[model samples]
Target: MKNDTVGRLKMGYLPLAFVFLFFATELSSQVNIADPFVLRVDGKFYLYGTDDKKPNDGIPVLVSDDMVNWSGPAGNAAGKLALAKGSSYGTRGFWAPFVVQNNHMFYMYYTANEKIAVATSDSPLGPFMQQEFRPLNDSLKEIDPHVFIDDDGRKYIYFVRLINGNRTFAAELADDMRSLKPGTVVECINQSQPWEIISGNKWPVTEAPAILKHQGKYYLFYTANDFRSPAYNVGYAVSASPLGPFVKYKENPLIRQTDKIKGTGGCEFVTGPGEKLYMFYHAHADEQSPTPRRTLFSNAIFVPGKAAGESIFQVSENKVFLKSSAR
Candidate 1:
């Protein structure tokens, strides 16, 4: 009788131990992607970012149903890629992917081999590839391509040009969506503010440009400082037009590092349940050592200036931590 009781006790404990181990793995597993951008289509969210673990895979994508629990692409346990390497223009260095839908096709604007390029796919979970394997323009080395289409249907591409230490620039994209329009290139924002300077030096580094149009004004959201710096943060500039004579907000560094997290930047906005705005970004995995392999984070944005008829965006210090468990 005592042996029977012991066997039953051991079986009950086995299930309990398995449950605990599963949740612990879920809570501790990091996404391991940098420069995350979330795109919501038909109530399902697809995440694309710089693939730190498999750079040769081109762009890696993760999927989520409720924005809290994320899984590998296509319900796979692991190893799924949206843009495969050698299938596109870039041989390596694919970073900062931004996607947009036009005419029933999805276009992915991203950095490859330190140059801005665009690839297209029928679906957002894309094997996005280029018609001809080439960078957008070969005149200069650029990264971080953000394509914005205005209300009147004019398209503009905002990117980081390596002219004077990673300065941000904007130009009209040609109708083909593969090249820039002639004579439309304009410098959007330069790193002149003190917070934008890196390591007490006047190093101009403003990249990861995201444009949000609200109340008929263009708000350009960008990251400042070297991305590896603990001081790397997010700020915004307001302009009347897409190609902007943009004015930096008086209160800059909108999304900054906290006591626990460092290298907090790479801001991308998306609307969640009931139209609540959320900003997705990444931070250094280790506080002491900043590297390319960062962890993803998101937070709710409170925009009081929008109620006042202005272009202002604010993210709370409290973040929404995403788990890598079953959705």
Candidate 2:
């Protein structure tokens, strides 16, 4: 909202619309992955997301060197998927994917048919397959899986459960990392902020959970409002423990709708080429619509909050547009 782009280009600044046009050619011509999640392993970045292009083919992945200029759905030639449908779980509705490496194996936690599942592969460019094809729990519909491991080696899975609305929850994971530790499931956050009410429906919503443990605090990042609305955006809560009474930031909607970017939610953080922290997110195809999303990258930094003794994360107004040649 502050328009840092203007100040950065003061010497030879083109009109904002023209600048958008220039970047549009570099971006719109390629990558269209929605609900994007990027994983950096061994100096290379692997991107996984809701495959709108091949919704029923399991999760699709792309490889990149600089977090821009992507190559391949990697192994998705001839309809092959990183996690193929038949080889894993769920029949349709493949969405939001987050991957983590543990015990020398890459585990991909993702959504399919509104359910959560984890698949494993030897390589980051995965032919990820499930050991057992089943949802984490079939009792209720759930989606958007994010796995976080504590410094003590405790594993937790954070996700959204469709109850009164889309509420965020977390549960300690079993040793196998395929199921939950019984009786550990706990509600993490609710749709309490005014900005979260953009859906204008009876059901309030808070989805897309990504957790970060920093300075002994658990930062629970989530997206609110219906993903379809341009008002959809991201916010975060903080707690002393992984599952807890988390407090939403006093100043929220960290990332929001800008003149050139809309529907700014569904994000994940990754350390990029220069060891700089970057947030990968998707905006609607254009300024006025919410379909055919395009991925965008922005630098993120930790900052002191308005409240005393509080720290928060901020995303830069600057952004990078890259083409996903594989798309």
Instruction: Give the candidate number with the greatest lDDT.
Output: 2
Clash count list over all predictions = 0, 1
Candidate 1 pairs with clashing backbones: none
True-structure RMSD, every candidate: 12.0, 6.1
Please write out the lDDT profile of model 2 over residues 21-99, one tens digit for every residue: 4466564356788899988777788888986667887787788776777887685423546787788888898899888
Question: Mind giving the per-residue lDDT tens digits that candidate 1 earns over 1-327?
Answer: 010111111111112332344355564556767888888889998888887766656887778876656787542212457888877788888899988888888888888889888889888888788778888887789998887777777888889999768889999988887888999999988888888887655557998988777656787889989987888888889888889899999889887567768888777766655445567888887867766555554444434464465635566555554556434
Per-model TM-score on C-alpha atoms: 0.86, 0.89
